[model samples]
Target: MDERLETLAQRTGQWLRTHGWRLATAESCTGGWIAETVTAIAGSSDWFDCGWVTYSNAAKARQLDVPATLIDAQGAVSEAVVAAMVRGALARSDAQVALAVSGIAGPTGGSPGKPVGTVCFAWGGPGAAVRTQTCRFAGDREQVRRQSVIHALEGLLQADTTAKSVP
Candidate 1:
C-alpha cells in the first residue's frame, strides 16, 4: 500500500471512531481498493461496516440499488450514479456514513468526452447532504485507482468535518 494512502485511511478510521460512526463503501473503478485500504488499519472493523464492489453496471444496480435507467442515461461513471450508490450503501448497511466511487481508469476505456482517469466520487450520510465530484486524474490505470482511493478517503474525512460544523 502507498504510504500516503495508508495515512489517509488511518486518519479516516480515527475520525470515524472518534465520532462513533461506521462507514460503508460502494466501488466501481477503484474496485474495492478504498475498502481494502480502510480495512488494513487495525480495529477498522469498529468503524467500517461493509463494502460493495459494484464493478459492473448490473452489480451496481442490483447490489447498491443504483437505477439501471440512471446508469444508462448518465453513464456509470457519472456523479449521479455515484451519489445513488452512496445513498444505497447507507440504506442497505448499518452505517452512519458512506462513500461511492466510479471511474474510467484504464488505458483503453477512454473516450473523447469521458476519457480515462475520469473518476466521480460521492460522500453522504443520514443527516448530511450528499456531496459529489468529478475529477480528472493524470496517470495510468494503477495510479488512477490509487489516486481515487486516496481521494475517497480524504472526502470521507472532509465530509465528517463538514457534518461536525453543521450546528
Candidate 2:
C-alpha cells in the first residue's frame, strides 16, 4: 500500500475517465491487488468495471476464455497466456481497456528459465495494439507481489500513453 502506488492508480483513473474508457483486469500472482488498488479510489466504479482472479489454469480457461491448449503450450506465466488473459478480460466485461498479469511470485516455483519473481504483463483495448512486458524482480513473496501490483498500474498508464501518442 504505497502512497505513490495509490497516486499512480489515481493518475490511471484520471486518464481512463478522460478517455471515457472502462477497465478490467485478469490477475494471477498478485491475486486481486490491482483491482483492490483501483477500487480503493473513490468513484472508480465509473472506470473500473471488474477484475478476475484467475490464479489457476482452469479458471483462466473457464472464466476468461483463455484456451487450455495455449496454457499447456506456453505455460500460464508466459506472454501468450497474459495476452490471452487480456483478451478474455476485455471480452468478459464492458470495459474498453484490459490488463492481465501472471507471475511466479514466491520463495519457491523457481525454474532456471522462469524463476520466482518473474512477472508477465499485457495490456490491450478496443482497436489498440496490445503491449506485453516481462520483468524479473528481486524480493520475497510479499515484496514481489507488491512490485507486481505497482507494475500493473504503471502498465496501464504506459499503455494509454503509448496509444495516445500513436496518432
Candidate 3:
C-alpha cells in the first residue's frame, strides 16, 4: 500500500474509534484494497468490520444483494449498483458506517460511454442519507485502484459531517 493511503487509513480508523463507529466496505474493481489499507492499521478490528470483495456480477448480487435487474440495466459500475452495495454492506454487518465502490479499472474494459478509470462510489449508513458520486480518474489499472482506495478513505474521514443518517 502507498504511504499516503496508510496515513489516510490511520486517520479514518482514529475517527471511527473516536466516534464509537465501525466501518464495512463493499468493493469491486479495487478488489480488497480498501479493506487491506484499513486493516493494515494496528487495532483496526476495534472499528473495522469484515470487507466484501464482490468482484463478479453474481457476487455483487448474491453477496451485496444488488438486484440482478439493476446490474442488467445499468451494469455493475453504475451509481445504482454502488449504492445498493453500500446499503448491503451496512445491512449485513454490524457497521454503522460503510462505503461501496465499483468501477472499470482496466486496460481493456473501456467503452465509449463508460471508459476505463470510471469509478462509482457510495457512502452511507442506517438511514436515507446516502451520497453517491462517479469519478473518472487518470492512470493505469494499478494507479486507478490506488486512487480509488485513497479517495474512499478520504470520504470515510468525512462521514461524521456528511452522513446525517449515520450515528
Candidate 4:
C-alpha cells in the first residue's frame, strides 16, 4: 500500500469520526480497496459501514442497483455509472457518506476511448450533494488501483472538511 494513501485514509477516518459520519463504498475495478484502506485504521468500524465489490455489470446492477440500461449505454466506467453506484451505496447502507468507483484497471480491458488506466469515481452523501471525477492514470493494474483508492480517500476527506466548514 502507498504511504500517501495510508496517510489520507487516516485523515479521512479521523475526520469522519469527528463529524459523526459513517461511510460505505461501492467498487468495481478497484474491488473494495478503498474500503479496505479506510477500515485499516483502528476503530474504523465506528465510522465504516460496509462495502460492495460489484465487479461485473450484472453485479453492479444487482448489488449496487446500478441500472442495467445505464451500464449498457455507458459501459460501466463513466461518470454516470459511478455516481449511480455512490447513490446506491448510500441508499443501501446506514452511512451518511459514500464513495464509489468503476474503471478499467487492466492490461486487457482497454478500449479506444476508455483505456487500461481510466478510472471514474463518485462521492456524496444524503440530500442534494454529489461529486464525480475521472482520471487517466499511467501505471500497471496495481498502481492504477492504488491511485484510485488514494484519490477516493482524498475526496472523502475534502468533502468532510467542506461540509464541516459550511455551518
Candidate 5:
C-alpha cells in the first residue's frame, strides 16, 4: 500500500472510531483493494464492516442491486452505476459509511470516451450526504487500481470530516 493510503486509512479508522461509524465497500475494477487496505490495520474490524466485489455487470445487479437496465444503457463504469453500488452497500450492511468504485483499469477496455484508468467513485452515509467523482488516472493496471483505492480512502476521510463539522 502507498504511504498516503496508509495514512488515509489510519485517519479514516480514527475518525470512524471517534464518530461511532462503520464502513462498507462495493468494488468493481479495483476488486477488493479498498477493503483490503482498510483491513490492513490491526483493529480495523471495529470500523470496517464488509465488502463486495461485483466485477461483472450481472454480479453488480445480483449483489449490489445495480440495475441491469442502467448497466446496459450506461455501461458498468459510470457514475449512475457506482452511485447505485454505494447505495446498495449502505442499505445491505450496518455500516454508516460506504464507498463504491467502478472503472476500466486496463489496456484493453479503452473506448473513445471511457478509456482505461477511468474510475468512478461514490461515497454515502445514513444522512443526505452522497458524493461522487470521476477520475482519469494515468498508470498501468495495478497503478490505476492502487490510485483508485487511495482516492476512495481520501473521499471517505473527507466525508467523515465534513459530517463531523456539520452542526
Candidate 6:
C-alpha cells in the first residue's frame, strides 16, 4: 500500500474511533482495495466493521440490494447505484458509517459519457443523508484505483470537519 494511503487510513480510523463509530465498505472496480487499505492499519478492527466486494452487476444486486432495475436504468457506475450501495452497506452492518465506490477504472471500458477513470462514490449512515459524487480521474488502472481510495478516505475526513460528527 502507498504510504499516503496508509496515513489516510490511520486518520480515518482515528476519526471513527473518536466518534465511537465503525465503518463498512462496499466496493467495485477497485475490488476490495478500499477495505484492504484500511485494514492494513494495525488495530483497524476497532473502527472497521466489514466490507463487500461486489464486482459484478449480479453481485451488486444480490449482495448490496442494489436493484437490478436501477442498474439497468443508471448503470452500476452511476451515482444512483453507489448511493444505493452505501445504504445497503449501512443496512447490512452494525457500522454507523458506510462508503460505497463503483467505477470504470481501466485502460478500457470507456464510454462517451463515462470514460475510464470515471467513478461514483457515496457516503451515508443512519442519521446522515447519503452524499454522492462523480469524479473523472486521469490515470491507468492502478492509479485510478489508488485515487478512488484516496478520495473515499478524504470524503470521510471532510465529513469529520464539516459536520458536527460523521454519520
- Using lDDT as the measure, the top candidate is 6
Off by over 4 Å in 1: 159-167
Q: State residue 131's C-alpha deviation in candidate 2, in Å.
A: 0.9
Pairs in clash, predicted candidate 1: none
Q: How big is the RMSD of model 2? A: 3.1
Task: State how far residue 85 of model 4 sits from its true place (Å).
Answer: 0.4
* Candidate with better lDDT, 3 vs 6: 6
lDDT per residue (tens digit) for residues 43-138 in model 3: 999999889999999999899898999999998998888888998998899999989999999987989999999998888855547777788999
10 residues in a row with least lDDT, candidate 5: 158-167
- lDDT at 156 for candidate 5? 76
lDDT of 1 by residue, 77-101 (tens): 9988999998899999999999999
Q: How accurate is candidate 5 locally (lDDT)?
A: 0.87
Flag regions of model 6 displaced more than 4 Å. Answer: 160-167
For all the candidates, what are their Cα RMSDs to the real structure? 3.3, 3.1, 2.9, 3.9, 3.7, 3.1
Residue range 1-167, candidate 2, lDDT tens digits: 57987898899899999999999999999999999999999999999999999999999999999899999998999888898899889888999999999999989998999999999988887787678888899989999999999888888776434322111
2 or 4, which is superior by TM-score?
Answer: 2
Please give, for residues 54-99, the per-residue lDDT of candidate 5 as tens digits.
9999999999898999999988998888888988898899999998
Give TM per candidate.
0.93, 0.93, 0.92, 0.91, 0.92, 0.94
lDDT of 4 at 79: 85
Give candidate 5's error at residue 25 in angstroms: 0.4
Query: C-alpha displacement of 113 in model 5, angstroms?
Result: 1.1
Query: What lDDT would each prediction earn against the true structure?
Result: 0.89, 0.89, 0.87, 0.85, 0.87, 0.90
Where is the poorest 10-residue window by lDDT in model 2?
A: 158-167
- How far in Å is the alpha carbon of 140 misplaced in model 6? 0.7
Q: Compared with the true structure, what per-residue lDDT tens digits does model 4 show for residues 30-83?
A: 888888888888889999999999999999999888899999998899988888
